[model samples]
Target: MIGVDWGTTSLRAYRIGASGPATDRLDRPGGILTVPQGGFPAALRDAIGPWLAAGETRVLLCGMVGSRQGWVEAPYLRCPAGPAEIAAATTAIPFAGAELRLIPGLTTEDEGGVPDVMRGEETKLVALAESLGTALACLPGTHSKWARLEDGRVTGFATHMTGETFAALSQHTILARTSVDGPDVPEAFSRGVDRARQPGGLLHHLFGARTLHLMGRLEQAETRSFLSGLLIGHEIVAAASGVTAVHLAGAAHLSALYAAALARNGIAVTQHDPDLVASGLRQIGRSLGWV
Candidate 1:
């Protein structure tokens, strides 16, 4: 079976064996947004054409590929959903030589009753639910998610635009002029996290980066990491209440940053590979009897 994690800016395909582990994988930058003239079919062919030619007959896809703006809208499943619920709602499409299935996203509400949703993260959550049973899981990205899973079901979740905000401020604001792109400075990052614990709140703390820079106390190269820590630190303080440990799933670099921030707050961290998307798609496929 071919498992595809087709997000907005990247496309990743994995060949899952009958037993479970992925046998091979493919990755490309031709995400939905990069597809030419809505040529999703062609893009898929370009990325995994050889795998299909090798006789792979079934495909399971997750992520933005199922978004309203994607190839086909697979609609979201309301929260308290699990792999069974996702499998039951899987949307199938027939390609030239294979059967393609798409997993639906998950949605839940905050304390204010405002709705929040996720697409690709649901697949990873399925894998997390199976492994951790009940836990708090964090998938940090452009829109980071803090999900609560109980007995293998996603009960509730919250979203924070930490990464997106960091990017915007670092690239589009005055902060950009003072920011430097380089490896994260742990000391600077930790200092930002410590500042987040203080009273003035995120908005006020955000300017602290600039103030320190102007005072020549914070070097230009460390500005970005400090800003990153401030945002991530505030995000954790605001969204990670009551959870003792967080199961982080995503790129190692981003997850490492979140893990460090969480650790400073007395939260233990268990990191999982972002590649769980492949295992997750396979699990859902088996549940649906489609593998």
Candidate 2:
């Protein structure tokens, strides 16, 4: 069986045996955004055609590829769902020789009734839940997710735009004038995290990034890392309330940054491999009897 994690800007496909690790893998920039109006079939065939030709008859897809703008818009499955529930909701896409299924995203509402949704992350979270049981899981990226799991099911979750906000403030705002791209500065990042616990709000703290630079207190090279810490710091404060530990997952560099910020907040962190998506796809596949 082939497991595909296809998102907006990237596509990852894994050929899994009956058990154990993936036997083959493929990574491409051929994400949903790059697919033409009616080119999903071609794009998919071009990427996985070799495996298909080699006798792979089933493909399970997750992520933005199931989004409304992608190949087919799989509806968002409600929370309190596990692999069984998610698999039951899988959306099937007709193809020539293989059975292709798109995993549905998950949706939950806040106390105020505002809805939050996730696509690709659900697969990883399901895999995490299987290993860790009930826990608070964090998947850091452009939009970070803080999900609550119980008995291997996702009970609820929240989304934080920390990464996107950090990018905007550090690159497009006045703060950009004082910041420079450089290696990670642990001390500067720690300082920014500490500052988040100070008085005033995030808005005020953001301005300080600029004022400190003008006052010669914050160096230009460390400004970006500082800004990152500041944003991630505030996000942790908001999303990690009442939690003592987090199961973190994502790209190595971003995960490291989030781990540092999470640790500064007194939260225990257990990092997981980013490839949990394949585990997730496999788990869901079993439920669907595809493997």
Candidate 3:
């Protein structure tokens, strides 16, 4: 079996073993955005050719691989969707003369008229929640999401685009010239978290990240960490303050960052192994009775 988590910037694949889990892992730079014309399997095979089994059963994928911008759009199932519902809607796209089972995404609207959509993270969030017997979860990402669940049913969620804002401000905004990578200074990050915990002034605090660097209180590298801490900590404080037991999802690197931000705010966080999406997808496939 082949499991894939294909997103905008990267594509990750795992070759499953007899234990019903991935054995050899592979990664490629080309993702859904990179394959605008759709050569997903060739790209993946090129990356994982050494581990290809004689008769690979199928490729189970989630994320932007099923977005409208992807190789194919697996239309989103509505509110209250489960693994079974997502699996039932899986569309098999032919690539490199192979069939790939694509998991559809989910969508719903909040009270504020904003639309929420999630792809790969949904499966992992559900699977991990079930594992921990957790009923409430917050998965941080380019667009961070807060999921509410119980007994495998996803009740509702809210999404905050904190990661995207950080990227935009650093790379595309005026701060790009000054921003640089630095260590995860706990003190600086904690300051950001405290700033975020307040009920108001996110806009002002956001500007402070830039101004602090200019005023010389923070070094160039620490400015980046400060900005990251400010936005991400603000997101955590706003999203997960009342909700206990947030399940930080996505790639390990991102989960670690969010975990730290949450910790700075005194919130208890649990980091799920990144494989639950595959397990959840496999579980979804088995529940759908896919052969």
Taking all chains together, each candidate's TM-score versus the true structure is: 0.93, 0.96, 0.82
**Per-residue lDDT for 276 in model 2?**
93
* Alpha carbon deviation, residue 162, candidate 2 (Å): 0.9
| Candidate 2, number of clashes | 0
Query: For this target, which candidate reaches the highest TM-score against the unseen true structure?
Result: 2
Report the poorest 10 consecutive residues by lDDT, candidate 1: 17-26
Q: What are the clash counts of all predictions, listed in order?
A: 0, 0, 0
Question: Any idea what lDDT model 1 has?
Answer: 0.88
Q: What would the per-residue lDDT of candidate 2 be over residues 1-291, giving only the tens digit for each residue?
A: 999999999999999866899989999998899999999998999999999999999999999999989999999999999999999999999999999999999999999999999999999999998888899999999999999999988999999998888888888989988667889899889889988888899999999998888898989988988888888898888898878999998999999999999999999999989879889999999898888
The regions of model 1 sitting more than 4 angstroms off are none
- lDDT tens readout by residue for model 3, 44-78: 67765565555675678888878878777888776
- How do these models rank on lDDT, best leading? 2, 1, 3
Clashing pairs in 3: none
| Candidate 2 ranges beyond 4 A from true positions | none
Cα RMSD (Å) per model? 1.9, 1.3, 3.2
Q: State model 3's lDDT.
A: 0.73
